[model samples]
Target: LFAIAFALLRKYPTNEEEDFDRLIDNWSRREQPLFIERALPAVTPNNDEPPPDYHSEENLLVFNQAIADYLVTSGYTVSCKEFCREANISINDSADKKDQLEKKWTSVIRLQKKVMDLELKLQEALQEATVGGPTREKRSPGEWIPRPPEKFELRGHRDTVTHVVFHPTFDVIASASEDATIKIWDYESGEHERTLKGHTAPVQDIAFDHTGKWLLSCSADMSIRLWDFQTYQCIKTMHGHDHNVSSVTFTPSGDHIISSSRDKTIKIWEVSTTFCIKTLTGHREWVRMVRVYQDGTLIASASVDHTIRIWSLPSGECKSELRGHENVVECIAWANDSAGPYISEPIANGGTEVCSFLVLQVVCW
Candidate 1:
């Protein structure tokens, strides 16, 4: 009878093995006679009467009571009907109770999935907000977007303007034109302040000194002119190019100026002496534009030969030659010292379309 009760305890799953063992021990002490009469008939050999019914109402009552006592001792406050259902026992109202339990479990699982989905959506919304949200300008399919309107126009040039430059330290601007003049203007008010006239031919390019006190202009008349910007007077005229002077720029130190010409040469001149200090000659065609490094250590020139040459300043030695443009390289501009430099050239087959290339590094020879 004890072995049969132990086997019955091992067959059922409970929260803890020790709790079940304690339950069996309590049952043995409280219902020893009931267990012996109900569970030992199968193993008794000489009994002539039929074995007691295992499913009798009296046996069922004893089983339910035993489970109720175990739950109370284990600190569980479940009702008798709940404990019977947990043990898989069939009672009068068990089917309805089982249906209700199944519905409740299904609802809980569905609600948990919905909560996870909502959490995911909320995370995505927060990420979008942190990343500055969607773009403000949305274009429709096949719509033609127009370019932004110009802020203001300066209209003092009587002919096609060759170049325009802003003073480094002031609100003044200077513009060169084919009308044989350079016009200085108050850029903030769009008022033409003065017209500088010295070149017999069209002025090609203009530049301002580092101190913004002087200006330089090169012209097709084969001469470079330095002007006092404050007094609007030509201070010095430099004549060295055999052909048209195309471009000119002052060095960052304001002690020298560099000029390029259709004669295929670049001349570095002393600002005070007005004498050519060095001449860089390597381009096979006309040099179009020239720019100096901020530290006055390097100079770069663009040419009609479809190449750009980097030269060491004051040494006149070519450091490197950059060649990839299909047409004449026309302009070069440098960003801040940390941002590198770029050059622009017109494409050979594309009308009026220009392509810019970045100058990554210059290796000295």
Candidate 2:
């Protein structure tokens, strides 16, 4: 429920952003040689509004394995039809039962077989291609470069990693996974500092307000939760999103929150008052992303239907629609910020340039 004691970094001017970026970029992505690593047992779930029980996932896996072993030991090899018939299971054509269906089953055994066969064949193919075909530098068109990921990892989420976020002002990373908990990690130090468990459903989405003082989460359980990031406690549950709440965001002023849901509506709530200030209903499909401008004057919405729309804030007037992206516009970023004096100045060899220095000098004593 508490962050381990550490020094907080001071915010520097935009001109010094390069320095900060360099510091973080040069920060070793490699981990130190620490002694033993251990998986701490997570806290028991609270049933009050519990997310599904992922705690018993291991037990379920073990049971399945035991069942498979028993079947194998009894000299009953799984013929798809026999397996389903003996099990007295019926799967609709849409959701087929692996063993009974004509389609290749994506089972544990089948998956392992696929991996072994693919790897074996790929090795031979690579050898043949290398011996008789063109070299890497002399390859023909359509050759894969085999470049590795910029940043990829096997994140150890027992179930699903529902949400991932970087800290507003720190190198810290937070993720809420279907393990029915939230976890904070120091990606720089490769240290998992804390795991937060409270929500009972898969946390759909999460956001930090402008100041990063508070965190908000919406879950499939049709509830919006307010969490005090410092204390790591759920302080409030704003239960208005009737269906699965898909996304939640705090306004720039941190006084209000805008949330979108499978309920096909977006609700703006006054956080301090915990009251629904306005409900925006227009999208035919699920509204995926809702963002408020820094001035709190505009709200931008992106949906599954591939169009983006902007709405006037607080008043809930539909303002304008932005058309371009040809897919589900799940994300939007207002990256353009007015440059202050400290950010940068342009160089001019032949023509005049707007001087931020002059503007600052005129405004200052």
Candidate 3:
């Protein structure tokens, strides 16, 4: 009975012994999940590291040696390490890699040049499309189209064809006659398009502004008429040019007009309004012809005094004189853009410079 009691008491162990048993229980509980169902099977590592990635080691060696030899020939005294760094290739001292890079770079440059050339050709083609004709369908081969004559007669004009000019953006021509009528002709077909009639007196001059949307006529009836090219409506009749308005021209901007009269005064008239803006005063005789320069800086007028006077367009002040026409100056033309001479500034010592010296950076033609 005593032995049984002692054994039962021992089953309830000492504190130190109980603590060690609890620790062992906890450790085994944590390790149980690590094995899941069971521990994994062992595998040995691969024996010879992977097979080498080398291809043609002999050829590669030959190329590397050739590069070293060529570099020496080319006077490059670079070490192999330095060459590798400079070449930016993956392999050190590899001539094949260098050759590959050279070929790739050359291909890239060739492709870039081809792109640039194609872009230039595209721009030229677009330019030809706009300037050559209205539409692709309107293209008439050179053999079919008639060339414009340097001088052509307007048979419809009973008197002398006092003025003739092309339409600004179309295949049409306009002429003013001393017989008091203005006629429009098809420039390509050589056919009469329309006849504008309103002035009782002889039509002395005709002009089309930069847009070709309006036609302006000055007449011996002492009036200037503005005609819409589309509707042929008399948009406005200017009554300011004293006596007979002999000659007229639209400014390059189409904002204002200039007219010369036998009344001895030249008037600048504003478009869209019948008001006269300025009356140039200088001529001692009747003004015969007036022209507006392309630059819009000067107004040239001819008179019976047989001299052409150039006045500043903005202030109406006389700028220069071209004095040699013995008769009434009939006509004048500026040099083409190709022939436009540059006005050079005087040198420090009073010598003249070549026209190209004062040239603007951008070439117009």
Candidate 4:
């Protein structure tokens, strides 16, 4: 039994008493002589000496001490009961106390292993952050950077300005205001150049065409008007929405204009004839804003319905709906870069928040 137990301990090399119990239970029912013959060489203490009678208490004590020494040198701690069990020796002790010590030592070994793993991970992180690695910028004590001063402000709008856009090819700015007008300004001189006045109600949005030749304006009067920006003359008026027209923008080619309305619809217009070519109708609440993708193949609209929907341009079919906003979705924009497309929502009371997603993926923020 001692020879078999020592052979099992040497083969498995574990500190747990369960391993010794399992091996004894498995081998004790087998033929004794054959087991002794197979286990004698494995449990032998030395090459030059004949095998000792391992069943003797003295021999068992010598073998157990050798195993205990090996375990200690290899950085393992085993209890007296476990060490004795590995040599098939019985011990008299309170079962509860033995179990408590075994559990405590097991927990200590587990915690030590966790600490070693954490130390290794911390060392790797420190190595990556040192020597000009791609880490966050570090600021020195008492050092600071100042913000640049504002250049100029264009101040002519009598009411809250809802939208402002820079001209595509000129040093001009177009701003729509609740004052029922779209104001043109010379940005370099910060001068209010002219105010285009035709809308009977507040002008909600204004967008310059791709060539900066025309400006599209939508208003609370339920109308979208195109203007010859250079002459400051109203070119044409397109009307189809039953409620306030909230926002408008020209498609990338400048051949069509897209407008969103409080009537929960998006209308596509032909720029040449001032005709409503198609109307998209999936939003359940007021459509707040609309924008065309750079390629003119897709259109995105946000609504008080708390969702943003992407629609195919010509077919006007709803492609995807993104939902997560707890309040109204106020605005949407394309980054036109590798960082991908994003939408912005204004909190009911004030601040602006932004959400980004991969183009056409339809994920919530």
* Per-prediction TM-score to the true structure, in the order listed: 0.56, 0.50, 0.51, 0.57
Return whichever of 1 and 3 wins on TM-score. Answer: 1
State, as a TM-score between 0 and 1, how close model 1 is to the true structure.
0.56
Q: List runs of model 2 lying over 4 Å from the truth.
A: 1-154, 323-327, 339-365
Quick one: RMSD of model 2?
30.7
| lDDT of each residue in 1-365, candidate 3, tens digit only | 11221232244345433443454355346443343223322344468665443335664454454444333343444343344344343333444444442353356446556665886999978765555454435565552343344334547778878888889899999999888999999867778988998999899889999999989999999999999999978788899766988989998899999999988788998885768989997777778888776777767777766556667789998766555444555444443345452332222234433233113213321
How many Å off is the CA of 165 in candidate 3?
1.1
Residue 119 in candidate 4 has what lDDT?
69
TM-score order of candidates, top first? 4, 1, 3, 2
Better of 2 and 4 by lDDT: 4
Clashing pairs in 3: none
The candidate that achieves the highest lDDT relative to the unseen native structure: 4
The residue-by-residue lDDT of candidate 2 on 1-365, one tens digit each, is: 00000011122223323443344333223211110011123456787865555437554443333333332343333322243343343323213222321121225235445556886999978865654455557776555443344233536567888778877887777887767677778877777788777778888788887677788888888888888888888889888877888888888778899999887788999998888888998887887777776667777776776555667786797755544445566655553345332112111222212223224435542
1 or 3, which is superior by lDDT?
Answer: 1
TM-score of model number 4 = 0.57
RMSD of every candidate to native, in Å, equals: 23.1, 30.7, 30.1, 21.0
Regions more than 4 Å wrong, model 3: 1-154, 337-365
The Cα local distance difference test for each model comes to 0.74, 0.61, 0.66, 0.74
| Candidate 1 C-alpha lDDT tens digits along 165-270 | 9999988889999999999888778888889998999999999987899999999999999999879899999999999999999999999999999999999999
Model 1: colliding residue pairs:
none
Q: Which of 2 and 3 is ahead in TM-score?
A: 3
